[model samples]
Target: MMKNYITKEVLPFEGERRDLANVAREMFNRKMTNVAGGNISVKVTPDENFSYDEVIYEKGHDYLLMTPTFMSEAWYAKLNPSQILVIDLKNGKKLSGEGRLTREINMHEEAYKANPKIHVVYHSHALNCMFWATLGQDMPNLTEVTSVNVPLGKIKCLPYRTACTKELADLVYEELIKLGDKSEQNIFLLNSHGVLITDTDLHSATEVLETVEWNADIAYKQAIFKKLGIIENYQSCGNSLTI
Candidate 1:
């Protein structure tokens, strides 16, 4: 069952769906996820003055605004504000928007249940991130940013859990709660599925998304080098390749 926990403060959503579209497009353009793969969401306190079909909403109540689950081929990249859904996470109710959310919503809810500070979540099927997930190993830190940013050594690659199941969500929730407030470590590599990241804002969430993938790519290259017996000496990535 969906439930609400301690809320730090009410941050009502002020922008239109296009605001979410910008980030979603960025992830898509960067080849972070397939057209229908990743999903993005944000928790917000509904505006008291706003009403749905004549029913007014309470300002302090938390609601999730997210993208549509099923979309036409081109719609994923050209997402519109009208395509976003606003749902009441408390009782699993839909407040607005057309179509259902991605099955990954369960994991997103679990993240919110674990930490009140998290306001946004991005789950993508990025190639590199998913590559690490299949191995069930901590991503090697060839770069300092990956070590410090994904401070848990590497992004946690969750064990095999069926997508949309309570077990999957709970594991992700518990894993994140243990980290306390390190929202950047929000990255979660789902076993045989994909990746998830929780953040207080879109900016920081997007920032780490690129870094994690870069680290994963670097690790892949290192593995290849080791296979070919290129070099045993340390190859430090002194600068961030987070572009």
Candidate 2:
């Protein structure tokens, strides 16, 4: 059942927040996520409009602006502005906006808490990404582009859990921490689910998402080459990735 905090209405957001929404629409259009898959969130501090969970998140600390679950729609449908739900992260409660907040709300919340410096998170059902997630494989930095900004070290994957549950959120938090400090984790794969990327903002997170998906796709193709004996004797640059 979809829960509502207020009447159905198209709410307006400021410039940066609006940019976040636009980027989300672009992410959707880019096939990073379908109507049913994927959610985007940004950490925001307490403001004049919201005043709950002050003690939990600290008066001036960051919370989240989570998109509500999209109802039945085509894959290419645009999400209205009213669909965005503001959440008080201290507790994943809907602070404003309408419609039900995403079932993955807890996942987004725990991710923010897992990394203090990560102010943005993008969880998407990007193709090729789901390939590695299901195969229990990790994304190795296979290119100079991915090797520098993204680490060659494997991005960890967690076991599957029912989405929108505390268990799922906890599993993500546990795996995300292995990437080192909260701020260092570039991306994580949720088993049989999707990819999650953390960054200082939406655009940066989007970049990481693109790079990670490319790496995932490349890694799979390389594995195919190995299987076909096309690169049976391939060697690496003294690393896990094959050449």
Name model 2 segments beyond 4 Å from true.
1-13, 46-59, 71-77, 182-185, 233-243
- Clashing pairs for model 2 are none
Using TM-score as the measure, which candidate wins? 1
lDDT scores of the candidates, listed in order: 0.73, 0.68
Q: What TM-score do all the candidates reach, one by one?
A: 0.83, 0.80
Model 1, C-alpha of 200: deviation from truth (Å): 0.8
Find the number of clashing residue pairs for candidate 1.
0
Task: List, residue by residue over 121-143, the lDDT tens digit for candidate 2.
Answer: 77888888888888766655575
Per-residue alpha-carbon lDDT of candidate 1 for residues 95-167, written as tens digits (9 for 90 to 100):
6676777777888888898888889888888888778888876566666676664453546778888878989
Alpha-carbon shift of residue 197 in model 1 (angstroms) = 0.4
State the displacement of the C-alpha of residue 52, model 1, in Å, after optimal TM-score superposition.
4.4
Candidate 1 local distance difference test against the native: 0.73
